[model samples]
Each structure stands twice: as structure tokens, then as C-alpha cells.
Target: MLKILATADIHSPRFLDLFIKSLNKVKIRPDLIILAGDLVDKNNIYALKHVYEILINKYEEIPIISVFGNEEYRGFENKYREMYPVFKWLDDEYIILEMKELKIGIIGTRGALDKPTPWQSRHMPWLYNYYRELPLKISAMIDEARSKGAKYIFLVSHYGVTYKNLEGEPRNIWPYLASSRMEKIIKDKKIDLVIHGHTHNGVRDKINIDGVEVYNVSLPARREVVLIDFTPKSKVFGLEKWLYSGG
Candidate 1:
């Protein structure tokens, strides 16, 4: 079985202490760590060092993969990559990892919003078209992973992919928070699992999209790290209840 720990929206230094405390209580040593994004606050790139220190000190060289969040800022993507080569950062990219002879394909992205924010629409006019095309681009990536013999496929994004988890947030603003387009890809591809964050006020952290498990691992919403255990046979043991038990 492959054990994974996932979380996002650390906004580093702000929630760094709480995150440290939370990690200290985890009894399971995950095979993989997924940071959905927003590692630092408002492009405070340097703060990621503190987050890196905390995780590295505890997990050592355990593979940690991440994606860019909105606060990560598009222009600084390469800078973050150069600064931290240890963490594999994926922005609308895919990487295949072999663990226990199981090939796990992780597709990471900042994700798309059905409706771009006012600031984005005004400043980044191309964003509207980009968001519209993201679903198809991601779908192609899934096919690539499958062709490469990936037994399990994971979609990791910075933005919430579905509105089901955005229960507490204002219903009318759901389009601005995530894209239903992504949801269609998940269903069509039958992705093994989906992990994302950015919705801090969401009430449901876990939901099922056509039997595929989707988790909103925002640190603020769940107030804890999310744990998942998966096997090569496509059996997933969700640890939502287990996490609350002194994790």
C-alpha cells in the first residue's frame, strides 16, 4: 500500500507553527507528501524555506511534490523551482513514480476557475481562454499517463475542482472558486483520486465524484493534515476518520 499525506494553504509563517504541531502528531510515515499549494502568503517566496525545513527535518528525503497556487504567483514559478530543487514542482505537468512496484502518475496544476476573479480578468485577459482549455489539456495528460502504464493516477491542483466540497462557501461564487469542467474530466477519466485546496471556508473536505474520491485538503478548512492509503489494485483507504484520532 502507498500511504500519502496531503495538505495546502499553509500561507507559511502564518500557519507554520500550527502545521508543525500537526505534523508532529502524525503516527504514519507517508510514502509520499503532497502540498496542494499556497505554501507561502502573497508571493512571500522566502517563507517556503521554513516550510521546507519543517518537512525535511521530519521526513528527511521522502518524496514531496507540489503545485503552484494562486498566491505562488505565475511569474515566480521558475524562481521557486530554482530555490528548492528538492521538492518536485509541477505546473500542469505529470510525473510518474514507482513505489512497491506500483506506478503512480501525479498530474499537478494551479487548476482553473469557471469564472476568473475580477483582478485576474482585468489584468490577465488570456486567463479566460486558458481556463477554458485546461480541462482538455489535463485530459490529454491523463491519457499520456495511462499509455505509460501508470496503475494509479492522481490529480493534484491548487484550486478546488468541484463545488461539492465548497458547501460552506457562498453558492453563487462557486464558479469563481473552481471549475465544473475539471469535474467532467475526473468523471470521464475515472481518476483514482483528486487533491486540491484554496477554499478555506468549505465545510466538506471529502466527497466522491462518481466513485472517484476527491479531497479538499486545505489546512484551514480541515484544521489537520489529510492522509490516504492506496493499493496497486485501486483500493483506497481514506483516513478522514483516522486523522482525527490523534493524528
Candidate 2:
């Protein structure tokens, strides 16, 4: 069985204690830890060290992979990557893991939005074009991973992919929050599983989009580190016992 522990939107050290408490309760050590995004609160560079140290202390050699969030900002991506050499950061890129019989390929990104947010429009006008082209780039990357003999594919993003998980979020802002464009690629590419964050009020933690199971591992919403078990037989066990509503 392949075990993956995932959580996101930690934002800053404010959620560090909750995250650490949750980790202590996990009896089975996961093979991998995935941070979807937003580790720091608005690019609080110093606070990010605490987050990394806590995980490193608990799971020394376990590989930790991550994508950037809005808080990480745009131009500072290189800075974050250089600062934290411990994490394998993916920006619309992929990494393949060989776990016994299963070869897992994970593609991570900050994700795209159908409509740019007001702040994005005013501050980063280039995003208007970037979002349009990201899905195509992601599709090519998926093909590249498959050619490399990746049996199982995982799509990890910082933004929601399906509206089904955004029930509690206002409908008007849904386009700004995520991209239906990327969702199309997910369906077309036959993605095995999708893990994402950035939706704090998302009521549905998990949903299926055209047979692909999508998980919202936002820390503020789920209030616990989400554990996923994938077996060689293609059976999946999502340990919901570890998850509870924050409200």
C-alpha cells in the first residue's frame, strides 16, 4: 500500500500547533508528505522554516513535495525554492516515485483560474494570459510522465478543480477561485486523483469529477492532515476518521 499524507493552506505558524498535534496521532508513517500550497502567510518567509522543521523532525527522510500558493507570490518563487532546498517544489511540473510495484507521478501547480481575481487583474495582468496557457502545458507534462512509465497519476494544485467542492464558497467568485479550463484537462487526461486547496469554506472535502476523485485538504476546512492509502489493486482508502469540521 502507498500512503500519502496531504494538507494545505497552513498559511503560517498559527496552524502549526494543530498540524503538529494531528501528525502525532498518525500511527502509520506515510511514504510521502504533500503540501498543496500556502505554507506561509502572505510570504512570511521566516515562518516557513518552522513549518518545514516540524515535519523534518517528525519524518526525517520522508520526501516532502509542494506547490506554490497565492501567498507565496509570483516573482519570489525562485527565492522560496532556493531558501527551502528540503522541499521538492513543482511549478506545473512532475515527479515520479517508485514504491515497490506502483509508479506514481505527481504534477503540482499553483493552478489556474477561469477569471482572474481583482487583485490579480490589477497587480498581475500577465496572469490573464498565463492562466489560458497553463492547461495546455499541464496536458503535455501528463503525456511526458506517462511516457516515462508512470502507472498512477496524481494532480496536485493550490486551486480547486471542480465546483462540487466549492459548495460553501460564493458562486459569483467561483471562477476567480479556480479554473474550469483545468478541470477539462483533468477529465480529458483521465487523471487518477486530484488534491488541492485554497477553498476554506468548501463544504465537500472530496468529490468525483468524471471518475477522478478530488480532495480538498485545506487545513482550515478539514482541520486535520488528510491521509490517503492507495493499493496495488487500485483500491483507495481515504481515512476520514482523521478529518473533522473546523466549525
Candidate 3:
């Protein structure tokens, strides 16, 4: 069984503490580490380097897959790319990493909210075009991953995929923050798992949509690394083997 660790919506200060704690708590070294998004506080290259260095030292053998969040792109996009080269950035693109015959295909987009919809008009008008373009972009990534012979597909994003996982949060606020387009793409692609972080108050529960599992794993809620076990052609993955230091 291949062990995978996932975390999202870290936002720098909270992430530093949890990251160190995760290193101490994880019993077995992870084969793959997935950072869903919002890794740094703003567009701080120094903070990004610090987190990257820490991960490289602790999980030397494990391949780290990541996507940029809205926070990372808050400033100049070109500069952020220059600062952090360790990540295989999946911003509206697909990246496939194979390990021991097990192919982990990752497609990610830092989703946005647009206008004409009630959610976008009230808040996050800046992201109007982002939401409009994200669905098609994700679909293209899925096709690319399938073409590359990926037996297992994982979708990573900084936005929440479904309202089910965002149940504890207010209903009206959902549209502005997370994207329903993300859920549509996951369901259509029949993805194995969708991991994301934007909603800090959201629960870390799995929602099965036609056999696909979508997990809302904001760092504040989990407070530790979430370990997932996946085998090629398996439907249900195992969880709850490890705990975050604080949780």
C-alpha cells in the first residue's frame, strides 16, 4: 500500500507549527506529500522557501506535489514562480508522477468566483473570469492524465469542491469562497479523490460522489497531516492511522 499525506489552506504562520509537528508525528515516511494550496501567508518568497526546505529535509525520499492558492498569486505571478521552484505547480495544468508502477495523476486549479452568479456578484468580483475558465481547464488536465496511463487520479485545489463538506459553514458564503464547478468536474471525471483547503471552518470529512471521495482538509481543522492509503483499482481508501500533534 502506498502512503499519501495531504494538507491544505496552511496560510504560513499556522502551517509552520503544524508542519514541524507533522514531521515528529508521522510514523512511516510518506511516499507522496500533497499540499493542496494556500501554502504561504501572502506572496512571501522567504516563507515559501522555509516551508519548502523543511519538507525537503524531513521527507527527502518522498515526492512533493503542490498547486498555488489565491494567496500565492495575490501579488506578481512571475515573481512567485521565480522564488519557489521545488513545487510542481499545477495551476490550470496536469502533472503526472509515477512511483513503483503506481501512477498518481494530479490536476489542480486555484478556483475563483465570478459575477452573474449570486455568489460572485456580492463578493470576489475579481475572480469572475477565473471561475468561468476553471472547469474547462480541469477537464483538459483529466484527459491529459488519462492519456499518460494514470491508473489513479487525484484532483487538488484550494477551493472546496462540494457543499456537503462545507456544511458547518454558512450557506450564503459558499458561492464566494468555494467553487461548484470543481465538483462538476470531479463527478464527470470520476476522480478517485479530490483534496482541497480554502474553507478554514469546514470539516475534514469525505463525501462520496459516484464512488469518488472529496475531502475538505483545511490545515486549521485538521491541525496535522492526513494519511491516505491507495492501491491501484481500489474503491475505498483507509484513513485514521495517524494523528496531528495537536489534534
Best-matching candidate per lDDT: 1
lDDT of 2 by residue, 104-207 (tens): 88999999998899998999999999999999998999999999998778999998876778988899999988888878998898888889999988888888
Higher-scoring candidate on TM-score, 1 or 3: 1
TM-score of 3: 0.86
Candidate 3 lDDT over residue span 1-247, tens digit each? 7777888876776478876676667777788888888888866656777688888888886778887786776545566667666666777777777887777688876765432356445765656776778787788878888898876778888877766677778888777667777777777887877788877887645667777767766777777767777655454543333454442
- What residue pairs clash in candidate 2, if any at all? none
Q: What's the lDDT for all of these models?
A: 0.89, 0.85, 0.73
lDDT of 1: 0.89
* Per-candidate total of colliding backbone pairs: 0, 0, 1
Clash pairs detected, candidate 3 = 114-128
Off by over 4 Å in 3: 114-126, 234-247
For model 2, the stretches where C-alpha displacement exceeds 4 angstroms are: 234-247
Consecutive 10-residue window with the lowest summed lDDT within model 1: 233-242
Order of all candidates by lDDT, from best down to worst? 1, 2, 3
